[model samples]
Target: MKIRLLSGGVEVRGILLAAVVALGLSATTAAFACEGGSCVNGLAYEAFGPAPGTGSPLLAVFVHGDVSAGGPADYMYSYARQFAASRENVVAIALLRPGYYDRAGKRSDGSDNGRRDTFQSSSNRAVSGAIRELRRMYKARAVVALGHSGGAGTLGVIAGADPGLINGLVLASCPCDVPAWRASRGRGGGYASQSPVDYLSGIPRGTPIVAVTGSSDDNTHPELASNYVAKAQALGLNARLQLVGGGHGFSSGVGGAAVSALGGMAR
Candidate 1:
């Protein structure tokens, strides 16, 4: 469960080790959310950390893919818990995509939110809005954005829109180049303009990004992840590509890679 940073220096390895230790020692968990008025954009989410006014906290938001198979919240919670454990001043959030869990811990009927753009601008906007709302709610000084599978695409949109919003990003099993993937599926109706690859040039230079995928993954294709790292680096972003042994879902390496990236943000 190690990540070989593509363009990172020797210190990256040490940072990752320290991140692992930090996460191993964390034991605090308390649910949190926006109080009083309705939540931003009516998005549903779960959060863990010290009470909002108790202390300033580093923010980490984890986004999950489709919910057809269920357990999106539980799956993301596992990673969030690990992240929360690593930093005493950190708050971890698991943002459930629209129509998955549109309210606090409540699953929806799996209906589309009446958008023609599907996973295009509409989906991206929703994710970006969630991040913005979370930041506003917590007044976090730093943010680490993480996503898996389809959620990775959403994070890409957020990064491209405003790289400064998150200090670091971790994308696992990302189908960033949507057009190419759609073409491979023998489909003609895909949003080329909304793909993550299309927005790489828009990310702020020097923004830290880590793209990870499994060596055995065919869903997003490991090459896609590598391609994202290459393109981001070409655009002058601090990016890394990690390919671990597994499939399309989150693997142990994915968590380690994210923790390492978050650790790097402090340096």
Candidate 2:
């Protein structure tokens, strides 16, 4: 892969290009819209905390699970609001349309529609842009990323693009091998052969990461979180794994724990 060094760090632009080619994704498919308290590109992002006041330490970017954006019922907004209220700059992003992955007979394009792939590709692009904007506009000292399920993979892609952009990551109930899951369901194009695990390998050491999983989360194996932690540890990253007592849905206590863990890292 082609590697370009910038400011003493390697930029894996070629890896992203290869990933796009392997997934059969068009570079132009990722579009964005930021308006009226909503930043909806591939994902819906909302910023909080006084519009980047005079001095802010960092910006926390949140990525929600497989759902559209709304309010407290929306996990993305919930976490973003929680962090923002806790004196941290925050931005919440919703990356998938409601029921985008539902295999039931509810799609307008029938069962053969390629919705998941479209959603993932678009979300990744939007997140990349959001990170760039956060750094430029807010002068964020570091970026703390919080992602759930498929959103975790989107964060993984952004991490690959600019590892230095992220100072900490919180992954809740993430499906570690998303590309494999998509392939098993014949949605192979959603991810490339180079998985997020491979991408994490290149991240700088001491980049703190927390992998949270539900003890009863059958949808995403708890082992998946452990695996990510293990990989991060192998790469010399400051990574930790936690198991909360709940399913895929977020619990009040678990959410607080995740935010606290990430906050400590950012500080």
Candidate 3:
């Protein structure tokens, strides 16, 4: 894992820095369409398997964690690409969340502003907008959302506001309970508004969902995924929790787990 201090002054380590470099290096691939300034709602994105607007079986969008140094889309590029290659006619996209990849100095629909709401409706709107645009552009028959860590919080907001918008979800190492997690971290008053657990009932029932976490993850405990999946299942949602090896960060088997889970989603 090569660590690099990004030009923005954030110390980025591991495959994230490599993924960032991949974005710049793989500009000629099918996934690199947005590198020429083609962005949706000011968000930077890369596509794989098939180009958007050409039609495909599904559009699987991967959203990464809230990291200051690397783009939100950086960490999941390989996973997205691998998944795309495994399936026929699947369009994989890695979308950079607001403030992370400001293409041509354009902020992603008010996302760059520090005052932007974290997990509020505004944040959800930003993510949802990107997904919808990509979905429309690709003419995909179905949509799958893959979110990691804080991105899972954004996924929660999207699921809560528009349950039917996406067909499947993969939330990995999520801080399922924002309030509880915040309180545990000694942050009083907790951002309960951003918690995924709070929006359980809003997610459309039977939406194919897979929530996985590292068995030894201390950042976001494995119990968070277990408890959240329990609640989701109790609500008649097709949700399950899987404990994998490793810690808060990505493990060796996470990509395979995600690909297997997503491959099961109906097209």
User: Best by lDDT, which number?
Assistant: 3
**lDDT string, candidate 1, 1-267, tens digits:** 455666655423355776777666652111222233334554566677765665668888888765445443447877777777767888888776665653334442223344223356666677687788788778888788888877788888778876688778888888888877666656677352377888887787777888888888877788888988898888888899888877886754665665566666643
Q: Which regions of candidate 2 fall more than 4 Å away from where they truly are?
A: 1-44, 68-73, 88-122, 179-194
Q: Candidate 3, residue 92: CA error in Å?
A: 0.4
lDDT for each residue of candidate 3 in 175-248, tens digit (9 for 90 to 100)? 78876666666677724247788888888877888987877787778877888889888889889988888777
As a whole number from 0 to 100, the lDDT of residue 262 in candidate 2 is: 69
TM-score of each: 0.76, 0.68, 0.77
Q: State the C-alpha lDDT per candidate.
A: 0.70, 0.60, 0.72
Quote model 1's TM-score: 0.76
TM-score of 2: 0.68
After superposing candidate 3 on the true structure, give the runs of residues whose Cα lies further than 4 Å from its correct spot.
Answer: 1-37, 68-73, 102-117, 190-193
Ten-residue stretch with the least lDDT total in model 2: 104-113
| Tens digit per residue, CA lDDT, model 2, 1-267 | 676878768675576677778556543222112223343332334566756554755777766555433222244565676677777445433323322322211111111123333225444555676677656766677787877766676676567556687777887767666765554445645343224565787667877778888787766667777877897788788888999888876563456666677677656
Clashes of each: 3, 1, 2
Question: RMSD (Cα, Å) of candidate 1?
Answer: 20.2
RMSD of each: 20.2, 15.3, 11.8
